[model samples]
Every structure is written in C-alpha cells, then in structure tokens.
Target: MKCIIGLGNPGKKYDRTRHNVGFMVIDELIQRHQWKLDKSKFKADYTIVQTENEKLMLVKPQTFMNLSGDAVRPLMDYYHIHLENILIIFDDLDLPIGKIRLRQKGGHGGHNGIRSIIEHVGSKDFKRVRIGIGRPDSSLSIIDYVLQTFPKRDTEEVMNSVNKAADACEAWVHKPFPEVMNEYNQ
Candidate 1:
C-alpha cells in the first residue's frame, strides 16, 4: 500500500489560499479518479483507491498545517505503511509559482507542516511533491502571504500546476520515484 498526504489547514476559511495548494492538488486527483474522500479518521479526511497494482490511501490532514503530523503518524502506523511508501504534497515558497519539484528525501526547508511530519514520522526518507508558491515581496510577511489567495493573474497558472502535480502522483503509483521525478520535474 502507498499513502499520499496533502498538507493544509482545514476549514473553508483556508480554501484557495497559497498555503492550501497541497489540498488543491489532492482535490484534483480525487476528481480525476472519481474517488470520494468522504471518510474521516486519523485526524484526516481520507479514502482508499485501488490502482491496477496497488492501493493508495489519499489523506488530507485536518490537524491544520503546523501540526500535520498529529494526523500522519497514526495513519502510517495503523496502515502498516513504511516511510518509503509515503508521499507528501505541499506548497513551497522557495520556488517560483506554478513550478513543481519532486524529491525522494529532504529536510523541511522551514515549512512548519513538513517539520511536524518529520518530527512525528521520525524520518525524512519519504518522497515529496513540492508545488511552488514563490516567496512574497520582502515587505509582506510570510504568514500573511501564504494565507492569501493567489493573484487573479496567477490563478490559471497555479491551477495548471495542481493538475500536473496530480498527474505526477498517478505516475508515481506505477513507476519509481526517480522515474516520476524525471517525467514531472521537467
């Protein structure tokens, strides 16, 4: 079994904010597969979808962004999923908007969501799909910036990246991380 986790704050107030790009990507995937993530447990809204060769648990953590691991750790344990079988999708302020990067393992790079997951999971060996949100202007505080919605002009671009991220995740179910990275990191 494989697990795909999307990190974001729960509630409608957070919808469409830059910080919720991870949730947006998961939404795209759910739509494409017609999978309903209606079940709630492990501090998350999740569902299990079967691919041709594997079962994937799609999780949207409800523990908010900073304390995401409160949800992920228990899900991992209950499902008997190893660190290597997990893929976390989240926003990245370090890269330009609309860009997506994949990595097999890495530090949190100052993301509170990733930090919590790392602390709870006890390893950084899982894969990550980072959807770029770009850093805000120097005058804008990071918190204010990420909590805001994307600019009107950038909305299309951001949504396109979300679709691409979902595609990359689907590819990941059948291919190795490196192969999926090479295909999607272009």
Candidate 2:
C-alpha cells in the first residue's frame, strides 16, 4: 500500500492560502478519481482506492502543519508503509509560481512541516511533490505572504500547477520514482 500525505493546516480559515497548496492538490486528486475522503482515520481524513495492483491512501493530516508528523508516523507504522512508499505533497516558497518539483530524498529546505516529518520518520529518504507558490516580494513578510490568497491574475497558474502536481502524484503511485521525476521536474 502507498500513502500520500498532503501537508497543511486544517480549518476554513487556512483554505485557499498559499500554504494550503498541498490540500488543494489532494482535493483535486480525490475529485479526479471520484474517491471519497470522508473517513476519519489515522488522525487524518483519508480515502482508499484500489487500482489494479496498487492500494493507495489519500490523506490530509488533521494535525495541521507543524505537528503533521504526529499523524504521519503513526499512520505509516499502522499501514506498514516504508519511506519509499510514502509521498508528501506540499507548497514550496523557493520555486516560482506554476512550477513543480519531484524529488526522491532531500533535507527539508527549511519547511517546518517537512522538518517535523524527517524528525519523526528518522530519515530524509522519502518521496515528495513540491508545488511552487513562490516567495513574497522583498517588502512583504513571509507569514503574511503564505497566509495570503493568490491574486486573480495568478488563478490560472495556481490551478494549472495543482492539476499537474496531482497528475505527477498519480504517476508516482503507479510508475517508478525516476519516471515521475523525469516527467515532473522540469
């Protein structure tokens, strides 16, 4: 079985924020597959889908961002999922908007949620799909920028990124990681 964990804060207040890009992609995946994510399990909202030979768990951690590992570690343990079989979907402030990066293993690059997962999982060797949200202008605070919603002009870019990231995630699930990386990491 494979587990795809989307990192973000829960609640309506954080909805549509740049930091919630993970949630958006996961929602898109669920919607595209017609999967139901209403199950309250593993400290997250999850849905299970069986595709030929693969069993996939689509998860949104309810522990919010910083404490996301608390939900992930336990869920991974319970499902007997290895690091290689896990994928984390989250926003990346370093990349420009509308970009996508798929990586096999790496440090958190200063993302607290990713740092927490590394701490709990005891390794940096996990798969990840990072959607670019871009950095705020030099004059703006990081907090304010991440919490802010995308502008109307960037709506198409945001949606396109989400869709592509979702497609990359589905490909990652069924195909090899290198294949996904080649296809997504442009």
Question: lDDT per residue, candidate 2, 29-94, as tens digits?
Answer: 988878888788767888888987899998999987888898899888988988889999999999
Clashing pairs in 1: none
TM-score of 2: 0.97
Candidate 2, run of 10 with poorest lDDT: 38-47
Q: List ranges where model 1 is wrong by over 4 Å.
A: none
lDDT of each: 0.94, 0.90
Lowest-scoring 10 consecutive residues by lDDT in candidate 1?
A: 25-34
Best by lDDT: 1
* Total clashing pairs in model 2: 0
Write the residue-wise lDDT of candidate 1 on 8-101 in tens digits.
9899999999999999989989888789998899899999988999999999999989999999999989989999999999999998999999
